[model samples]
Target: MLRIAGILLAGTGAAHFAAPQVFDPISKAAFPDDTRQWTYRNGAIEVALGLALTTKKTRLLGLAGTAGYAGWLASRVRANRGASQ
Candidate 1:
């Protein structure tokens, strides 16, 4: 399960970086009016973290990265909602 999640994270991260326009719709739906731009750097970081997580020694790092990313996304959603109101 961890491996699958890691692969997915890496794949989605790559997609976001390689094709921002494609990712933008998904991001907009999830984040509403939050205007943060998803860039190649974000994708690279995710991929690196995912790779690290694949190794037993680096699983914690991967989890941390995932958690941080989730927190960021959540914050964006909240901020967008707050701004609209």
Candidate 2:
């Protein structure tokens, strides 16, 4: 399970770097003035987190990744709720 999660994280991280345009809009909506910078930062963070997840000594990284993902999810939910109302 951890391996699969690690692979997925790495894949998504690569995708973010490989195609920032795909995520730029979301960043723009969240932070209008600095979308590009934030997008790149997010991608870099993901790459680091994914790499850490692949190693046994980096459980802290996995925990951090989970926290980051949860924060993203929460933000998305908040956005959705605001949009619906």
Candidate 3:
């Protein structure tokens, strides 16, 4: 289960970096400057989190981080929606 989650995370991160244009709108709305950088940074972070999840020593930490990351992203999306409105 953990391995699958890690693979999924890594895959999505790879997708983000491979085709960042798909994330441009969210990046632009969530970041104040250099939206491209934000996109890449996010991709990198996801990749790291995925790698961490694959390691037994870090699996718990990685799961916590993943949850936190998801929550943070959701908050950002909500904030962006409010700002755009």
Whole-model lDDT per candidate: 0.71, 0.73, 0.83
Q: For candidate 1, which ten residues in a row score worst on lDDT?
A: 29-38
Tens digits of per-residue lDDT for model 3, 1-85: 8988898898888878899999767677776467789889888889989988987999999999999998888887777765643
lDDT of 1 by residue, 1-85 (tens): 8877788878877887677777665566445444336455566777887787677788898898889987887887666664433
Per-residue alpha-carbon lDDT of candidate 2 for residues 26-50, written as tens digits (9 for 90 to 100): 6665555566887787777777777
Using Cα atoms with residue i matched to residue i, what is each candidate's TM-score against the true structure?
0.70, 0.70, 0.81
Candidate 2, residue 46: Cα displacement in angstroms equals 0.6
Score candidate 2 by TM-score against the native.
0.70
Candidate ranking under lDDT, highest first, comes to 3, 2, 1
Error of 2 at 7 (Å): 1.8
Q: Which has the better lDDT: candidate 1, or candidate 2? A: 2
Q: Say which candidate scores most in lDDT.
A: 3
**Superposed model 1: Cα runs more than 4 Å off:** 29-37, 82-85
Please report, as a residue range, the 10-residue window in candidate 3 with the lowest summed lDDT: 76-85
Q: Give residue 5's error in model 3 in angstroms.
A: 1.1
Q: For model 1, what is the alpha-carbon lDDT of residue 55? A: 73
Model 2, runs deviating above 4 Å: 72-85
